[model samples]
Target: MSAILPPSQRLWWKEPVERIEIVWIAIAFVWCLILTFMMPYWHVFGKQNLSNEAYRTTPQAFAAKAQAVVDKWKVREVNGVPVVKPPAGADIYLVGRLWQWWPAYELKKGESYRLHLSSMDWQHGFSLQPVNINTQVLPGYEMVITVTPNKAGEYTIVCNEYCGIGHHSMLGKIYVVD
Candidate 1:
């Protein structure tokens, strides 16, 4: 037989060290690209400068006291039917439950209302955000709250304070209309 040559041999330039170096260079390039899009490659944390005060009393008492200084609720007629209205300039309330809220869908599209809220069980949070207001709803007492729908849109009502096990999921929606 003549001299035989095996084709299984590799080129000398295809070295293991070169392959490892190439992989490391590629990983470094990808890390740099990712860091360019990140918020901070190097930075410092800052602290607040102002003082904040805490409120202890419920907003319902504040609202009632504040509104009482201005006006009071009275019995009136709507389309000849007797109704309870806000003191000339107040919001309305749709019934809310433990699981959800049932807004007053029986009224006209742009009607307003005032809520005299209370609970039968434990203390609950009555919060309407973007308005910077929250009230503590207590048992056996009607906590009146005021809201005005300046714009017709969908708003969220979040319970800022915890209730029980289902605390985080406690939420409601408000539908304002023209």
Candidate 2:
């Protein structure tokens, strides 16, 4: 009765499949089609989807822009890193370099900011902890995402990509205050 028998001894093709088997196969095919259509549908209508807003820019230009923002609204320096507190609704920049994320950010709770991210030398992974926002940072491209901090606390920015020997030390911070 098994189909795996030798071809000379078995005529499995002549055997009729059961009605339940045919019904199951049809159900599976329809389910697959439904699942295939759901992917693009959710991507177009989902509320918590990733932004497709990005642009091309050089590393030097991006660094300059980030430095300017730092110099303009830097409240203080912590361990030689500037902690910038740009006003809500302003543009905020974060740069990923060889082994660090430059300059920390301070934002107000419930206010939105346009966060621009880029890398200097290599591809980096930007993973904001606690809130769990993850994105890829490229060297020659600038990626922008609008973020609103809904809670007041200290959040850590961890580089999840392995760049070099010091990758484990590549960390940044963001402080959200009321």
Candidate whose lDDT is highest? 2
Off by over 4 Å in 1: 1-99, 102-112
Which ten residues in a row are the worst by lDDT in model 1? 46-55
lDDT of 2 by residue, 38-125 (tens): 8788888864556789999999999999999998999987778899999989989999998888889989999999999999999899
Tell me each candidate's TM-score.
0.41, 0.82
Runs of candidate 2 exceeding 4 Å displacement: 1-22, 25-45
What's the C-alpha lDDT at position 57 in model 2?
94
lDDT of 1 by residue, 1-178 (tens): 2235533345735535677888999999999899875534332232211112222334355445434522334344333322333433454433333533323222223444455555445566767656545676665455454344565655566766677887667665544555
**Which pairs of residues clash in candidate 2, taking residues 3 or more apart in a chain or in different chains?**
none
> What Cα-based lDDT does every candidate model obtain?
0.49, 0.90
Instruction: Please give the RMSD to the true structure for each candidate, in Å.
Output: 14.1, 3.1
- Model 2 TM-score? 0.82
